[model samples]
Target: MLKKDIHPEYGPCQVACACGNRFETRSTLKEIKVAVCSSCHPFYTGKRGAVVIEAGRVEKFQRKYAGTRFGKPAQETEEKEQG
Candidate 1:
């Protein structure tokens, strides 16, 4: 037998999305906030853009390591050998 009053109250809840979308649902929480939802999710909207906060990080890494052998640049290694 399940005990009464042991579990928290369950009732209708409201969900608020960051994209300004709100909906009603049933949850333990009275109000919930989320960063993304079906209304604004990239997959659902089919709009894929840069979601990273720090942009250009990937480009910067590739540029810094271009033409490199091991961790050192190929040109630097050749110069050291000649010296």
Candidate 2:
């Protein structure tokens, strides 16, 4: 037995995936956003590589510390080498 009024409302919901896949299903939430879904999942799609979105932080870090002892900057080492 279940209470009639205690349960949250469940109805048709729209699910959006980052890969531009959208589908309708019943859920407690009216809308759902997901990073990956069955339509674009690697296992389902048979893709071997994972999707990665970089925001330049890795490039910035490497540029900021290219070659040094524990990352002291590349210019100082270059100057030391030349001197």
Candidate 3:
């Protein structure tokens, strides 16, 4: 068993989810703010890609890196072009 006074205060943690799901769990912190939770999570709720569609995070990333080549260094590309 852990000796008393050696550990940080462990008490109920109030979690506030973006989807209006509030639950209490044991943690060192008193409160936590989260963007997703089991109630509204895509995996738990069986919502495939719904969050991505609504948030546009995936689409925005794809658009930002669509033209970028992967696994090829910029210097290697320049050397190939020069030779």
What are the runs in model 3 whose C-alpha is more than 4 Å off? 52-58, 71-83
Candidate 1 to truth, TM:
0.59
- Error (Å) of candidate 1 at residue 66 is 13
lDDT of each: 0.79, 0.80, 0.80
| Native-referenced Cα lDDT, model 1 | 0.79
| Candidate 1 ranges with C-alpha deviation above 4 Å | 50-83
What TM-score does model 2 achieve against the real structure?
Answer: 0.59
- Which residue window of length 10 is worst by lDDT in model 2? 48-57
- Write model 1 residue lDDT over 1-83, tens digit each, in one string: 86998988889999998778899999889999887788877778887872533456778887888766656767889997899
**Could you tell me which residue pairs clash in candidate 2?**
none
Give all TM-scores, in the order shown: 0.59, 0.59, 0.66
Pairs of residues at least 3 apart in sequence or in different chains that clash in candidate 3 = none
